[model samples]
Target: MNGLRKGSLVTVGTGIQLINHITHEAVQSIRNAQKVVHVVNDYPTQRYIQSLNPDTESLNHLYGPGKPRSETYRQMVDVIMGHVRSGLNVCAVFYGHPGVFVNPSHAAIEMARNEGYEARMLPGISAEDCLFADLGLDPGSNGCQSFEATDFLVHHGGFDPTCSLILWQVGIIGVGDYIADGRPSGHIGILVEVLREHYGSDHEVVVYEASPFPYPIAGPMVQRTTVGRLSEATMTTMTTLYVPPLATKADRDMLGRLGLGAPQRS
Candidate 1:
């Protein structure tokens, strides 16, 4: 412990969009840090951060075709820890919410804490946050369940088909490595088959991708298609599946248990 140097690590999110999603606190963290490292999806956000702090470095270079995403994440953690070890106040920025499904951000924070450094993560607007707004959805209404597409298929997680289901990372469903062209070629058919089991062949579903740019005014791609036509929908690395409820609510017993009166059936 005597030879160990004291450093601090702060992880923040730039949100899913450009500069508009960035919070004032997160902006201050980037400006005040001795060194800044980031991984973002688009060039505009990257340039925005660089403009705020010229010393900023991008970790996106670690990703490559055929390279395992896990390996790339580990490398990202190493780069962040490297600066922290150099006794610099390091700040790591990621797209969307830093702690939401970001392996490298979590790994770097854990490693920094283990090394006796003060490490913290700040929340930012995630794709789900945008989805709820753009889709006119309230999670409290009918209840919402979210899962990674791969995990949902592999584990066959118990979920209610009568409620809203959100599956993330659908475009890269079965792939474990990075692809330069962002085209994934694995097990999409299997995912569609599994979904049909619960949603039925004609059940309507939506493939959603939140717009990252503000001025472009690109809203979510709400494709109203059956479960069987899922494979035909255009998907991207950021695409998420939204499954709406099939059953209408008429549970009088449950409603009475909660001390609520039942509504008149139409």
Candidate 2:
């Protein structure tokens, strides 16, 4: 079974945009793999992945209307394992960072390693990276908090409105099942109410979608609105909500303890 060790797995991300964000290393992994499974952005990206490896297969067909996404993810992981168990070097690529929100990527890697296969994940640019670039927001400037919209509403233990808040899957706010067309989140009002409790109704927020194709798709889409008006904001399954912090005084005692002065760096 020594040769079976050659049947390894590597998962990578295609990033947010098409063609541009794929890393050189990930490109090599795709080309070298005996079999590649991809769940990417659009047709063009699919073709690009296909061009890299003729053995590429798409898992998009696994998705079904009104189906639970957890099952879909499980099936995806199973498919990846099938390739690996067959002693084929497998590459499972997903959109955005493979490690970010891609459940199947993580599940497949864990399962592969558990089965004594060499499995590793490579990082790729995510929507969060594009959000930082497009919105000119820095997590370091003011500590940032990120959460899935439903998780934030249903089970958030604590969150700081005094820090930037990013709510992912804003367009699928309360959705429990998968929709083929990515139906607009029907319960955005619940999210707005939760945010309104922390930051007042008039506090500004943004609905952001990073462009996938870079044109007519509205490159790096951004819609600015207030917490109260968030319900009126446009969003898709890809949308993320950004809530900036309200003005607050720095902790003078902490600064003094650290022998530092008031804010100076920009």
Candidate topping TM-score: 2
- Candidate 2 lDDT for residue 233: 80
C-alpha lDDT (0 to 100) for residue 214 of candidate 1: 83
- For model 1, where is the 10-residue window of minimal lDDT? 257-266
Q: Give the alpha carbon lDDT tens digit for every residue of 44-107 in model 2.
A: 9999999999999999999988889999999999999999999899999999999987889999
In terms of lDDT, the poorest run of 10 residues in model 2 is: 1-10
Per-residue lDDT of model 1, residues 159-202, tens digit only: 78877899999999878999778785567788888888887889
Model 2: CA > 4 A from native? 1-4, 215-217, 264-266
TM-score for each prediction? 0.92, 0.95
Error of 2 at 258 (Å): 0.9
* Residue 177 error, candidate 1, Å: 0.3
Collision pairs in model 1: none
lDDT of each: 0.88, 0.88
